[model samples]
Structures are given as C-alpha cells and as structure tokens.
Target chain A: MAKTVHPDQRYLLALLNNDAQLINEIYKKCAGKVKSFVCFNNGDANDAEDIFQEALVDVYNQAKYKGLELTCPFEPFLLLVCKRKWLNELKKRAVLPVTKEEDSLLHIGEDTFEQAEQLEKQQEQSKLFLKAFEKLGERCQEIIRWSLKGEAQEKVAEALGVTYGYLRKKKSECMASLMKLVQLNK
Target chain B: MAEDKITWTARFVEGDLSEAEMAEFEAQLQTDAELQQHLENYRQLQQNLRQQLAPDAVREALQQTLGKLNSQYFGHETQVLSLKPIIKWASGIAAVLAIGLFIWAPWRGNLYQQYHVPGQMLVAERGAASETELDKAASFYNDGKYAEAKSILEKLYSKDSQNAQLSYYYAQTLLATGRVEQGRELLTTVYNGESAFKYDAAYAIAMSYLKTGQKTECKSWLQKIAKGTTHYQKATDLIQKL
Candidate 1:
C-alpha cells in the first residue's frame, strides 16, 4: 500500500525550493530540541549545530535524488536523524561512553527509522562515490560530471569538445572506472 | 569483450542505446547475472551522480540559508567575544591617562555579588495547590533563605524533574546554599532542555563558577551567553571585569 505523504513533507519541498521562511520555521520549531538533545548527550552546542546542519543537507540530498516522501512528521523524523548522526559522531570520537539515550525510546514508528537509515546509507554511498570520483583521471571526472548534468549527451559532448560517440563511450568507461574505484574503497 | 559489456550496460542504464540494442541487451541481461550486476551498478551510479553532480542552485541556496539559521539557532552557545584586542586598547588608553584611573571600572566589589542576580521564581500560575507552595518557596528565595526554598522546590522537583522552570530555581537554591556541583548539574540539565531558561541557566552556571573564584571557567561560561539574550550584557559586563 502506498503510504500517505505527511503534510510536514513541505519542509522537504522547502529545502528543494530554498524557501527561507519555512526553513526558518524548521529551525525555530526543531533546532532547540536538537541542541538540547545533543548537549545532554555529552555533546555541546557546536556538535549539535554541525549534526543538525549535516542532517538537513542529507535530507535535501535524499529528497533531491530519491524523491523522498515523508510518511511521518518532519520534526520527530528530523530529530531522530540528527540524534542518530550525533550518536554516530560520538561513537567515532570515543571521548565519552555512549549511554542509551532515554529519548531513543521515543516511538516515532519503524518507518521513520527506516527512512533515516536509508538516507544515511545513500549518503555513505555518495561519500564513497565522491571519493572514487576524486581518484579518477581529470578527463574521466570531467566527462562523468558533464554527462550527469541532465543535458543532452550531444550537448555535453559539444561542451566537452568531444564527439557524441566518443562522449558516450568514454563516459561509460569513466563510470566503469568510478564503479571499480568505489568497490575498492568499500 | 569485457569493456564492451560494461559500455553496453552503461548505455542501457543511461538510455543511450537504440531500441534494437536495448532489446538485445535486456535479453542477454536476463541470463547473464554479471551483466545484470553491471547494469544495476551503473543505474545506481547514474542516480548518485545526478544527485551529487547536478547543478543545484536551490541546494546552494538552501545550504546558505541553513548556515544562517544554524548561527541564529545555535550560535550563542559557543560564541566567545575576542577580548584581547579590546583589552589591549583599554590598557593603551589607561597608560596614556595614567592618573589613578583603573581599566577595570566595574571591579567595585566581589564579582559574584555584583553578578549573581537571580530572577524571582513566579511559577504560581501552574496550579492552585502548587501555587501556594511555590509562592512560599519564592518568598523564601527572595528572603535569601535558600535552604527553606530548596526544601520546598526539592520536593516539587522530585515530582516533575523535567520542568525547566522548577529545575532552574532549584538549581539556583542549590547554588545559593553552596551545593555547587549539584546545582550546576541541574543547571546543565536546564541548559540542555529546550526551554526559555536555557541562557538563564548558562548565566547561573557562570555565576556559580565566579563564586568559587574560577575566573577562567566563569568567563568561558559567560561567553556562551550570546548577544540578544537577557543575560548577555550582564555576562559581558562581568566578563570585562574578570
């Protein structure tokens, strides 16, 4: 069954549209809780701010790419995402013992957790892909970046000063190299 | 042959193949698991690349907007004022005026005494039964009988520890009675809660540190009170004296 999109998905659209007012509303309603939660969890305001910002960026990427639809309210969902990100950071830092947060018991539904986890996984893949892209030769990077820019292959080829047939062949080769690098990185 | 297969998979994923070639590729893909995996990886790569590399003015704009909002929302907690230049300038002027005027104009008395101005507890509108007891606690707090105030507030806090206002005043009473660690713990909890008492708790924590003559820690906490908060000016004033 298709889940009904929650009304709060407007926040995601706001991110896509750069709607400053709605984004401000998001900060006003949600940032405090995230800051509070991070501060309570052996993190400070700076850590909370970084985690919150990164979570918003991840959500933007997910909505931009995967056409993410919210099946849950945005606030709790955003909080859960930020909370998980901070916990991951805490684990990485290893400066403090990661205690089981009381709010981890918050019942936001399994779908929300699934959504947050999916975004995290996609973000991890993006990181891997980006690192691999960086390791590719400059020509390959240029071809791949241009070809993926939603332009016609012919126009991309023209922009890159290459023939259409060459652009297609070389883009595939570059992508294949990229895929191999990503596999190696993983 | 291997490179040809990879190229065909990418072309199939990107819709670059003609109908006849696509048909042939799909037919081969059904039986060839390696080709199927190659197709899947290319498809995933295409999606990821489009998402990652596509020119997104909105994404840039959103990032800029989020940077502004992050400052507005979480900026105050770590925004320490750079006092070195100002202090250097002040000392320069003090040397030029060298006629018995001190740079520390605000250092008239004990730093804690000058800055530890706790707000009155006025949580009476919560309920009738609690109102009388809270008002009594408020009276004791106002009269400087923090022990009496703590006795009542402690009892109330035990029932509703999540209440920011209660935790704040209880923390104040604990600080007043010299239970600095216990008081700071409560204040930290209040500071960590999403209540209006957050900066107030920070100010109280600063005052607690100041009372114990911990100037560095006090100034550190004081600097956490960003501009525009009720305690910002007072915290800065004390920071200057310190």
Candidate 2:
C-alpha cells in the first residue's frame, strides 16, 4: 500500500505548484509566528522575511528532490523551519553569548550547533568574496551585479541601448578589467 | 596560454560567450594556467564589487518594504481574509446586474442610462475580468510560465486601455519574456502617469532599463521612483544593486 501524504505536505505541494493565492494565505496565517521567532532571535522584520524566504526555499528544495513528508501541522512546521533558519543566521552574525531569553524562546533543535558552525563559515567566505568584489571599476561592478541577478546579455545590451555584439565585448572587457583590479589589490 | 587567450578568458568567466564559443573556451581552460588565474581573479573581483555596491541603506529599505507588505497582508488581522468573500461579492453583483438587465427592463434602463448603457457595463465587466486575468498571469509568472503570462496580460491590456495596474504588470511580463523595448514603453506610460501604480511602474521601468544595460537611464528612473512614496524601498534597493 502507498503511504498517505499529510495535509501539510499537500498544502506545501499546492504552494510549490504555483498557487499564489493559497501561498499568500499560508503566509498570512503563519507570518506572525515567523516574525515572533525572528524577533526572539534579535532579528527584525527584514530578517523575518529573509528567514521565511530561506525556509520556503529549503522546503521547496526538499519537495523537489527529497519529496518531503510533513508529519505536523503546516503552521508549526513552517515556524520551526523559519526558527531554525533565523537562529542559524543569528549564530553567523556572532550575536554571541546566546542569551537565555533566546534559548527559552526557541524550540532548541538537535542540529543547532552544526548548522551554526556551517553558517559561520559560509558567512566568512561571503565576506571575503564581497571584499574582493569591491576593487573593480564602476561599470564592471554594475555589469557583474546585473549578471548575478541573471540578466541576459541581450537584455543588458538593450538596457545600455547598445548592440548585442558590443554588450558581449563590453562584458568580457569589464571582467578582464575586474580581474586586473583584483590581481593588483592582491 | 597566449595573452589573447587570456583576454578571452574574462568573457568566459562572465558567461558572455555563445555556447560554441563557450565550449571552445572551456577546452582552452583545461590546459591554460595564466587563463585560469585570470578567471579566478575575475571571479574574486566580481564578488568584491557586489560587496562594495550593496548599500546598507538598501537592505534597510528592503526590510521596510517587507515590513509594509507584512503589515498590509500579514500583520493586520482584519485584512487577513480568504478570497471567498471577495469572490462571492463580485459574483453576486455580476449576477444581480445580469438578472436586472433581463427581467427588470425599466430598472435596467435607468441604471444603463445613468452608467452610459452596455458600454460602461462592458467596461466594468472587462475591468473585473482583467483583474482576474492579471491574477492568473501573476500565478503563471510565479510558475515560470513567462510567455503564457505575457500573452494573457497583453490580451487584457488590449481590452482595457486605462488600467495602470494591468499596464504595470504587463510591462513586467514583457520584461520577463525578454521583450525589453515593449516592456519599457508600456511601463514608461504608467511611470509617467499619476495613477496608483505610478511608483511601482517607475521602479519596474528602472529595473527593466538596468536589465537591458542602460545604466544611465536606469539610474535616472530609479531616482524618480526612490523619490516617490510607494516604491521608495524597492527603488532604493535597485539603485544600490545597479
């Protein structure tokens, strides 16, 4: 016999399947809980959204690859996920000496220490990459930033009001310039 | 590797080469030490550029925008409603109008004359239906069906000429579909208008311009949006990214 999928799983699947209204409704229902969790972790509303987004992405990845099986109510499960994400973020920020107030508020999951360490390392690498990115020319900086946002060459060309061929050449030149700058700084 | 190959290496790291060119470039990277170092340096520089350009103010502004969205859609308990009520009310009104037109001719005539007959009614119905269509388009967009959403939004825009919301969303759909010029033109109208979506339109137009690589135009439009109330946060964020 096939295993039965839980309501939370069904709801999440529907959300991941592009039911925006339903997803919006779910957000409405649990946003407060997520916000509270973030606040407890010394994160503001922006941090709350970041945590929510990250949790959603995590859930999406799980649904896509692992076929996640939700064994609890969606509200609690979502809150838990968001809580975990926010706590990890806090740990990375080195908000240090995790206060008893935060500890009391959190669910105190098993993966906390491991995830905290991982997040700290990732944050460190990101900081280094960002430091390296700062040495490029203004134009090169803009091109690379837009490219990272996944803008296409043709679109970038049109935005600059240049020919597609020219834009491609410029992008390469900008990258080369950036490489030179980084090498000089190093 | 030769110095000429080293220069092309920059294009390869930036993903600016065509597929065939990329294949050739990758083949070159396999054996070239100087080219590899150049590529690594380029990657590091790009990362640094992002760090330098990402303003703290932009992040704060995004947080504020998220706060507003939360307040509007999530924080306010009274506003947190199921779609059923709005759907019920719209359908109810539509049904009443339909019934009145068929059965109560005198009442219908009075309303028709007051509202300019079937023309106005048609417009109203079209407006409501267009909103529904736009909602569908948004769903399609979130689902990554940019072409389908663009087609629907375009059809809706054609039906309703003065819908700033539709125009704004249509422009977004166009941008997503890689029709940058058309998207910019459509969004420009909304951005120039004094309508409710003006700020959002301005911000989106700026983003579209940035996507197309018009840094100067994008900055100008972003400035306009940043000065506006409704889209200040988003505009600020885009400005920083640019």
Candidate 3:
C-alpha cells in the first residue's frame, strides 16, 4: 500500500539538505521532550543530547539510502526513535528499573512504530554489511566503492586506469566475492 | 557455485545484462531458488554499499550545525534564562536605576544587533577550492570584515547563481556592508525558494528593516515567520517590542 507521505517529511528533507533553520526548529520543538525522557530515566542532559543527535543521524542515513518516507508527524516519530535508542543505551549500561515518564507514553501510530523498526533493522544491516566490506581485499573494496558512487562506469573505469569492459568484469567478480563473504558471515 | 555463474548472477543483479539476457535470466529464476538467493544477496549488497559508501556532505554539515545548537540550547544560555525572573523581582527603585543604566548600556544596543544571529555558511564540500574560499568568507563575515567577505561571495554567487545557501550568505554580506537594497532583494529570492532558508531569509529581511529603523516594515516581515519555525519566538518578541 502506498502510504501518504506525511507533511512532516519536510523534516526528513531538511535533514537530507542540512537546512539549518528547520533543523533548529526540530531541536527547539522536540529536544525538550527528549531531554525530559532521558533525565527521568537513568540518563542526563548530555546523554539526551547524544541520543537525539544519533537518532537524527540515523534518520538522515535512512532518508539518504533507503528513501525513508515519514507517514506520521515528525515529533512523535522522533520521540519514538529516541525512546528506543535510550532504552538500548540503558540496556548496554545495565541500568535497572528505568523510571517511567509521561512523555515516553506517546500515542504513536502502528505505521510509525513499524517505520522506526524498519529504520533500526536497516541500520543494523548496514553495520553488518560494513563489517563484511572491511573484510574484502583492498582492491575489491576500492572497486566496489568507486562503482557504487553514482559515477558513470566508463568514467570510473578511465579514472581507475582500466577499460570499461575490464572494470565491469572486475566489478562483477568483486561483488560476487563480497556476496559470498556476507553469506559466510551470516 | 561455478565462478562464471557467480559473476553472471552478480552482473544480472547489477543490471549489466542486455535485454535478451535479462529476459532469459528472469525466466530461469522462477524455478531456481538458489539463483534467487544469490540475486537477493547481491541486490542487498549493492543497496547497502551505496548507502554506506556514498559521500555525505550533508551529514557532515548537519553534525557541525547540531554541535553549535547543542551549546546554545544546553549551555550557559539555559542558566541565563533561569535568572530572568530575578531581574524582574528587583525593588522598584532598583528597577528604575537599572532601567536608567540600561538606557546608557552598550549591552542594550541596537535591536537588529541584539537579534541578528547570522546563519553560518556550511558549504559541504570540505576541501575543494570553493569550500576553502567560502570558509574564508565565513570567517571574514563573522569577524565583521563584510567588505572582504562580499568580494569573495560576489565572485562565488556569480558562478553558482542558483545555489540558495550561497545566495543566502551573499545576501547577508550585502546587508552587513550597508548594501541594503541589493541585500534585501537577494534575501527576497531566498525567501521565495523552497529551502529551509525561507524563514531565515524572512527574518533577515526583518533585521534589515530594523537596521534602517523601519519598525512597521520590520514587524510585517517578522509576522511572516509563522509559529513552529525557529525564528517565530524572536519574531514575535520583535513584533511586540516594535
């Protein structure tokens, strides 16, 4: 089903385009809630700040890479992502009995919850892919990186001192190798 | 899997196969679960790689901007805000004396000066020649060397006439250097664009009016900044004072 693109997709666009004023609006309107949640939990203002920034970065990455579409208001969506992130942080720190906050009980929609889960999954897959990528030979890594940078294959080939045919053949082989490595790791 | 088969599968996932070969491959893939798995993995790799490896100047720019905002929101400014009521509760005699001193205070300077928070020019190309020149321009502009900043910005703006961010900073340099008409005109263009700078440009126009002591015009521009924008509070405050 084609989900209606929420008006708050503007916030996602702002993240992608690095629109400072709109981004500032995100902080101004949303940061207080995030700070309150973090402080009420086993966290501080600095912890909240870090979690907020990281969540925004995750949103940006999803928008840039996966074409993340927001179907809910950005505030609740952002708060949801921040809550999940803060919970994870608590788990990592082994903090016990997190205090309940009213803000954390935000009435988010099912679609928004699914969207946050998808973003988290995509981010985790990206980390695994990166881990596998680092295991590739330097030549394989270089070829794959250049090929995937949205440059023309011919231009990339020329820049890399290879013919178009050779670059294509090498790129295919490198990708094949990467897939095998990824499958093995999985 | 055979070496040739793996390469062929990878190439197919990459869309490197010709129309005839792709048609042939797709027909075979319906019954071939192993081929389907290989194809899925290759496709996933490409998507992940593209996402992971793409050059992200916007992300870098966003990080820098967030750092600055964090300081303002969570820094000493919060403490300063907490102290405001204390100032209001001072005795009437002390308040009168404070107002008398404030009338002569440099801190209570120009309205425009008090509120004109300049947007930092965060051009994302970190090490390019244009980026270096822009950094220099930003430095000069921040240091109040508007004339020097204006020269470099003018050259850049001419080359990239459609770059809204460049146009924004260029407009700021113009306004700073007393090129009021030219500055406001450029800012109008930014305000009309579909970027995040639209409200910022509006706020800049208001500041320019305040600079010229045009209170009515200033308030009108400030009114254009709707609620929920970063500038809305400042705009409303300015409007009330005006």
Candidate 4:
C-alpha cells in the first residue's frame, strides 16, 4: 500500500519529482520566516537564499539517500534545516556560532533535527567518497563510473578494447578496491 | 576465493545475476556474514558514487533549480520589500473589487451575498433626524449593530403598526438574523398593503425565500414587481441567477 503522504513532506516530494510549480510554492510560502531568521542573525538576503537552497538540496539528498520521512509541518522542518545550515555557514566563516534557535523551530521533535544532521553526515560521506574515487586506478574509476551510468558491460569493454568477462572481473575488483580506499581514507 | 567473492558482489550490486545465481546469492547473503558486509559496503559506495558523479546535465539542473528558488525568494521579495509596490498592488486589487461589486453585484447568487450593501432607507426628516428614535435605529443598523437596531425598530413598529418604512426595515432586521419565516411574513403584508415600500417588500420577500433556500418561491415573488419599480432591475437579475 502507498503510504499516506503528509502535506509538509509534499515539498520534499516536489524536489524529488522535479515539480517546478510546487517547488516554487515552497519558496513562496516558507522562505519568509527563514529570511527573517537569517537577516536577524547578521546575514543578508543573499545569505538567506543560499542557506535555503542548500537546505532544500540537503532534504532532497536525505530523501534520496537516508529515506528521510517528514513527521512535522514543512515550514518548521524547513526552518530548522535552514537555521542549521546558516549556523554551519557562520561557523565556516569564523563568525560567532549560534547555539540557540527560534522557539518555534526548536519545538519540533528531535528526529527531524536529527534528520538534518543525518543528511549532513551523508554529505560528508559523498565528499569523502569522491576524494577516494579520484585516488583509484584509471580502469577502476572508469568501470565504476560507467557501471553507474548504466552503460552496457559489452559497450564499456568495446570502448576499452577488452572482453565482456574481463570487464566484469575488473569492475568487481575495482569496486572492492574502491571500498578499501574509502575505508582507508575514513 | 577472493576473486570469486569480488565478481559475485559486483554482479549482485549491478543485478547481473540470473535466477538460480540470484537465489544462491540470497542464500549466501542470509548465511555468510563476511560476504554480507562486503555487499553492504559496495552498496554504500554505489550510492555515494551515483550522487557525487551526477551527470553534467543533472548538476546543471540542480543549479538551475537553486537559481529558480533564489529568484523567487530574493528577487521577488526585494521588490515586495520596497513597500510602495506592494501597497500599490494591494490598493489596486481593492479598488478593482469595489468597482466590480458595484457594477455587477446583483448576479451574486446567495441572498446574504446579494444584500451586502443595504438599501438606502430611513431618510432624515429635517431637524428631527439625530435625536429621533428612527435616526438612532438607522445609525445602529448602519454601524452593523443589528440586534440593537432590531430592538428599537420593534418598539417603534408596535406604535405605528401600518408604517411602510417601519415594516420594511424591521423585516430586514429579521432577515439579517436568519429569521426568514418572520421576515417573509412581514414582507408579504407590506407588499399587499398600500405603501411606498410595496415593490421593495416584494423584493425583500424574494430575498427571504433565497435566504431560506426556496429559490422557486423567490423567483415567483421577484417576477411580480413591475419594470418601473425601484427593485425591478435587481429582481430581474436575481431571477436569472435562480
């Protein structure tokens, strides 16, 4: 059975579905409070906009990677995410970091906030995985990349001037090798 | 053994295993802890790589999506924050709604909706206007103090039982309070009697029927008012709506 979708989570689905109209609604309805929070905390409109976009991307990635399920209203969840991202930005820029939040945002339950942290952790993993991928051998990187892109094994072998059986074998070895490198990097 | 493990893990991740092989792979996954860990790590690597290695087109789309959000939040908001433009647009819509209500009001279907701006009654009788009970009732009615006006009108109505203005305005009070039956009876009496409010009373009765969800009776009463009468135009519009 299809799960009953919450209204707030509709924004996340819009991001996933690439529905421009509904995504536009997310900006129209929810960005005002976020802009207020950002501007009040020594940031400008540009900063707020950047934080909001990043928050949205984080939500999208969480839904894609961490199976993020929204359990509260979208506005507060979005506000919490934007606030956290802005504080992280502030910390990155060497500004005095914010520990407190607007009472409205803080009132949402712990898991939603934890979801934001989880997405950030996933983001860190992606960054690490990319760096480790670059350290891999050329054939290992190409095989992994092509396999992900859904390029046929026979076609990849043809392009690399190798047999299909050898390509699969090399691809497997590369996956195992890539995991080892990622583990070592961590 | 290591090469065999690597090959099977890759095929399993890629769904390159056939039915028998996939069944065997599932059985091994259920029992073999080390192979399960390898599969889990490979899956995680696949997820991270798929995300980080997003195609150039997908990356551009993501940027464009963010740009769309940026323009909506900041660009439009900056214009709205100017206050003058927002005020201008707001007052413009208000003015347009006012003109719209004035020019094309009667076609509004609901009786309560149709009766938004009350009819012009209760003319000031020279110097007797302000201090008189009639003026007090008019003032109360105009100010939306319906219950107060109804009390004053009912007392005034008992004194002058045949007064057209008294009957009409008092019945309007009843209608406003959702007492459609009482309002309809008073309207019918004024409509039948010789009074200046005869046409108006007919129209009010029609309005009362509409308020009571009796459109058919409302239409019949509305159709009786003559063309040159004060309420003929409104009545005609209401009949068409019915």
Candidate 5:
C-alpha cells in the first residue's frame, strides 16, 4: 500500500526532528485534550502531566522506530494512547473504578484502536529488543547497531580489521543470536 | 533444503538474486510456508534496524519543551505551592538549616571529592590547534578553574554545537561544576555519537550514574565500553563493585 502522509505530518516531523516551535505547538494543540481526559478521570493535574508526557514519548518512539504514519488525525490517536495508558496506570495502582473516558473512545474504530494497541505491543517488543541486544557481548551489540545503521559493511569491516565476507557472516550470526535471545525472552 | 534456504534467504534479503533465481525463490516461497514466515521475520528485523535504535535526544528535547508549555498553559495550581509554609516556619527553618548545614556540608564535600575528576587540558603542542578559545577552555578545565572553563566552554559549545572537542570539554566542565545532570546529558550525547572522546564520555557517564546512585544504568554504560578504550579496566572494576 502507498504510504499517505497526513497534513499534520509537521507535528510528527517536528517530533522526529526535534523542532522546538512545532513541539510547543503540539502541546498547545493536543495536550489540552489529554489533560482534560486525565483530569476528568480520577487523575490530578500532576497525573495529567505525567500521562501526557508518557503518551507523547510513546508517539515519539513509534515515529522513530516504525516510521509511524498517522492513519487518523493526530489528536484522536494521541488521546487514545493517553486514555489507554491512564487506564493501565490506574489498573497498576489497583484502582477498581472505571475511568469516565471509558466509553468516550468508542467512536475510534477498529483501525485506530488497533494502531494504539500496536503501539503498546511495540513498546513491549522494543523492551525485549533492547534486553536481547544488551544480553549480547559488547562486540556483537556494536557491530549489529552500526551495521544496521546503513554503515557500509566493507568500511565497518575495515575499521574492525576484518574482511567484508567475515563482517557479513559475523553480522548475520550476531543478528541471528539476537533473534534467538528475543525468541527465548518471548 | 536447509542450505538452500539459508543461502537463498540471505541472497534474497540482500537483493542479490538474479531474475531466474528470483523466480525460483518466489516459486519455493509460494509452496513453503516456513520460508514465508522466515522472510516476514527478516522484514520485521530490517524495519527494526533501519528505524535507528533510540537516539533519545530528540524525544527528551521534545519532552522538555512540552513541559515548559505545560507550565505556561495548565500551571495555575503549581504556582500556589510557593514558599509560604517556609515563611511561616522561618525561625524554625533557620534553626533546622543551621543544624543541617553543620552535619550536611562535609558530606556534600566528600561526595564531590569522591566522584569528580577534572579532565586533562589540551596543550597547544605538536599539531594541536594553537591559542584558540577551545584551548583556553581545556586549560582552565584541567587546572580546575571550572567556572572560567564553563563560561568559555558554553560560549564555544553554543557557537559550534557540532564541535566534538567543545562539547566534550564543556561536558566535563559542567560535571566539575556540580551540574551532574546536564553534564551527563551531554556525555550521553558524546558517547552515543561519533566523537574522539566517546570512550571517555562513556566512562564519565557511568561515573555520573554511579554518583547519582543509579547502579544498573552505570553498569550498562560500563559494559558498552570496548576493551581497547582507556576506561575498560576501570569500568570493569567499577562494575564489579556495583
């Protein structure tokens, strides 16, 4: 499928590129909605602030790791994430009362909800990825991170004083080892 | 079958397969579900790789900016939490403060002495860039003139954010001046990035974590140092203690 860039691609690009003005605009534009959602629930202003920041960080993560193309508008998607996260927080804190925004997100169809779910799922997988990467010997972690970064395999090999073929074989072995670690973690 | 799968999977992912070879691979892919699953995993892995594993600076920057905006917009309640209570208990606070300082000042001094290491200054010798502000900052930094070094280093860092020498030395000055958090932030940037001082910054960052009582993160940073770096031995020793 052809990737469609949203009109508010600027919000995401601002986040990915760390554009200060645009980031401020995101808080100006979207944060109020999140704050309202959190505050209207049992969350205080501090809780609202924390939830909003956590949600934005997840959005940043998705954009950084997955090239997150906003399928729906940004606010709904962001609010969905905030609501889901706040619900999780409440659950973790053993709050038995359902949040007031429980059915507020019912209009966000299966796809948008699925995307939010995917973000949460990706968060778990990313933790696993980092854990597995760290579990490797330092050489493998360095080689895999640098190699995956589109660094020329030959140049990396030369830097390490190994042949290109050896680099490729070693990289593959390291990646396979990482995959095994992730699988075992799963 | 296994050998063919390995070679062909690698070749296909590499886009090194010829037209006929591609045709054969696709034909096999149609019949072989496991091959299909394997390729999907490869695709996910490749996607994971190309997306650049967590630079973190961007996200942190955004969060900092957004936090400021939050204070501006929804910060009415926060301001009301002022020092009124302290004013009410001013005399009591002064007595407590005097007692606290008597006991606390030496402990704070000891902590700084334990963790702070002044960075070695760059001398204008043998092919080094001579008589520059960077050199002045380095000299001041090494001489433990962190106040002068920090002022000069901040000027240099602001003027040329890309200069690794300025950033690295400035980060050290920041650390020396008891600004551990800001110093660690820059050290993190230096170590994660391509810099001559990456290994040094790695060691400094681990030390920062140690000083801050974050032993797990300290161990992780120490573990990332390759064996050839100057800090590798010290890092391992520190890791053992942690």
Candidate 6:
C-alpha cells in the first residue's frame, strides 16, 4: 500500500505536477505567516515576495530532484524556507556599510540558523546571474526585461513601434549577443 | 534571382513576410547558398543591436513594469497569490474535480478524468497491478531509463485497454526511445480523447510532433493546448518559441 499521503505531500505533489492554481491556493493560505516573518526580520513586501518565490522554487526542486518527502505541514515548511532566505538577504546587505536606518532594519533571530547556509548557497547563483546581466547591451537588456515580464513579441513591437518581425529577430539576436558578451567578459 | 532572394531573406528575418512568403523563402534557402549567407548576416545584425543597448536601464524599466502589473493584477490584499501558489491551487482543484467526477458522475466525470490519467486504477482489494507497474515506469522515465520504462508500460497497456496513464507515458517513452511514429500514434490517441491525459497528453503530442520536425502538426496541437485552460501557459511558451 502506498500509504495515504499527508495533505502537505499532496500539496507538494500538486506543485511537482505543475498544477499552478492549486499551488497558488496553498501559497495564499500560507503567505501571511511567511510575510509576517519576513517583515519582523526587517524585510519589506518586496523582500517577502522574493523570499516566497525562492522558497517555492526550492521546494519544487527538492520534490523533483531529490524526491523530498514532506514531514511537516506545507505552511511551516514554506515559512522556514522563506525565513532563512530573508535573513541571508539581510546578512549579505550587512557586508557593505549602511546608514543608521538601514542598520536598524537588519535583524535575524537565532532560530533562523538551520536553513541560513542553504539560503546563502541559493543566493550566490542569483547574485552571479545579476552580475552577468549587467554586462549585456541596452537592447539585450530591454529584450530580456520584456521577456521576463511575459510580454508577447507583438506587444513589445507595438510598445517600441517596431514590426513583430523586428521584435523576434531582436530577441533572438539579443540573447545570442548576451551569451557572447557574458562569454567574452568571463 | 539573388536580389529577389536577399529581399525575401531580409523580410523573413524582419518578420515582415507573410506565411506564404516565408515558406517560399525557406524553400529557396534550401537550394540557394547566397540566401542562406544573407540570412546569417541578418541574424548577426540583430545580435549586434542587442550588444549596443544598456542593461541597467532596461532591467529597471522591466522591473518597474512588472511590479506595477503584479500590484494591478493581484492587488495588495491578494498579492500573496504568487505564481507558485497559483500552480498549487490549480493542481489541487484539478485533482479534486477529477476524483469528484469519478465518484458522483461516473460516466461523464470518469470519462473526463480518464482522459487525463492515462491508466485507470484497478479496483482489486489488493490494489491495481497496473498502478504499481505504471509507477515503476514513471520512476524509470524520470531516471532516463526510456527503454526499460517503455517495455514495462507497453506490457501493462497490452493488458489494460483504456489506461490513459499507460498510453500517455508509453507515448512519451516511445519518443524518448526513438520510436517517433509509434509515440505519435499513442499521443494522437490521447490528444483525440481516446485516453485520459487530455491537456498534458495533447501538449506531449505537440512536443513529439516538434521533435519529429513536423512544425505544422506541432503548431496545431499547440494551438489546441493554448486554447484550453490547463496547459495554456506551457502552450503559449512553446508557440512563442516557434
């Protein structure tokens, strides 16, 4: 008997299966708790959002690659992940000198220790990508910007007053160009 | 002829050509070396344009736009509903609806759910033999054991006629194992309402068609998924690439 799975397992399974709406519902159910934790740790709504996204990605990756079995409720698991992510973000910001206001905003409780190391590792990849992104061209920058925002070529073309044909060409060209730039810079 | 070819290549790369003109351009490119070179040059020009733009301004503008859109769409109260959460909710609803339909409205609901599951569970007191086998096949498929997986799935499908999961996975397995035609057939069956994995099955079928270089067939199936609710984002993503 494949033992009757827990609710969190079912929720995680739903996420792994790429059922977007169900995942949203679970996120809605737990977002407040996660947000509170983030805010208490001297984070803002933007930080909460970033942490939530990273936590979800982490959970999704764990489920897909490592076959992670959920031993706790979805809320606590997600909250734990997001809490650690926010704390690390604060610590990274700390390495640079900060004003009195900024200094006061950097706080992390001792309980956030367990996942802090993991969050640090995850942040490294994102930081590297951001650094690489800076090396790309203006057009490459715009193309990637619109692309990430789920902008259609037609929309991008209309907004920029270019033809759809030019937009597609530009997008592929920009990606290739960025790849080359990243390579050259490296 | 070369002048005419270059003009067509530019138009095609610029996305100014109609479908018919694009087709003609591709056909001509197959036999015309000059046209191919011109097309490559056009591609390089586009790349150069990208290399000259400013990254920070573009990123800042994009981020601002995304932030505005996110707030507008979700509102502050519902901002908690992130992409991950939305996916989770959709899956849960889909599964509950599937199971509910299976019980309350057996004929219609089961039929609908069946289109998605690929392999229907056996009702034996000891649980279905095919369920365990299909699970094994899934594990194998995930592990990149296409051949071993396909063999098990195929055997189970032979024993169980209407198992959608089996048929769907088998089709995917076939594609992975290099049996494109057979995989296509099974995928078509699932896509055409012969099996349960309707949305995902259709998406897979379209992807398989793409793998076989049948862009037209791939587009058609992709269009179907794009129109449907469940697989819309995936379909949209693929169509954009095409």
**lDDT of model 3, residue B27:** 87
lDDT of predicted model 1 = 0.79
lDDT of 5 by residue, B1-242 (tens): 33445445655665556688778889999989978987787677666654435244666567667667767766644433346544544654465445434543434544323433444555333232347566677667756799899998886675345556678878888877776756776787788777778988887887777777788888898899999876676567557756
Candidate 4 chain B weakest ten by summed lDDT: B121-130
The residue pairs in collision within model 3 are: none
| Top-lDDT structure, candidate number | 1
Q: Highest DockQ: which candidate?
A: 1
Candidate 3 chain A worst ten-residue window by lDDT: A96-105
Candidate 4's displacement at residue A109, Å, is 2.0
For all the models shown, what interface RMSD does each have?
Answer: 8.0, 9.5, 7.3, 13.8, 5.5, 14.2
Q: Which stretches of candidate 4 lie over 4 Å from their true place?
A: A1-5, A98-106, B2-8, B11-27, B56-62, B76-242
Off by over 4 Å in 5: A1-10, A13-23, A39-46, A64-67, A95-101, A104-111, B1-27, B50-70, B74-242
Better of 1 and 4 by TM-score: 1
Off by over 4 Å in 2: A1-135, A142-164, A177-186, B4-8, B13-28, B31-242
Models ranked on lDDT: 1, 3, 4, 5, 2, 6
Clashing pairs in 5: none
- lDDT tens digits, residue span B1-242, model 1: 33467767766775667788889888898899988888778778777887767767677677778878888999654434466546654764455344222332355566666667665555433323334577788789867799999999987775446568889999999888876766886797788768988999999999888888898989998998879987887788778878
TM-score of chain A of each: 0.87, 0.51, 0.87, 0.84, 0.74, 0.49
By TM-score rank, best first, the candidates go: 1, 3, 5, 4, 2, 6
Q: Per-prediction TM-score, please?
A: 0.57, 0.38, 0.56, 0.53, 0.55, 0.28
lDDT of 6 by residue, B4-32 (tens): 54455655765656688678788888998
- Cα distance off (Å), candidate 1, residue A115: 1.7
User: What DockQ does each prediction reach against the true complex?
Assistant: 0.28, 0.14, 0.23, 0.15, 0.19, 0.03
Query: Could you give the DockQ of candidate 6?
Result: 0.03
Candidate 3 TM-score, C-alpha based:
0.56
lDDT of 4 by residue, A1-186 (tens): 644446678777888877788888888887888888888887988678868877787777778666777766777678777888788878877888544654544467665666566777887788799888877875677667666666777887887778887777677677767787887998
Q: Which order, best to worst by DockQ? A: 1, 3, 5, 4, 2, 6
Candidate 6 off by > 4 Å: A1-186, B1-131, B226-228
Please give the lDDT score at residue B148 for candidate 2. Answer: 90
Span of 10 residues, lowest total lDDT, candidate 6 chain A:
A96-105
The DockQ-based CAPRI class assigned to model 4 is incorrect
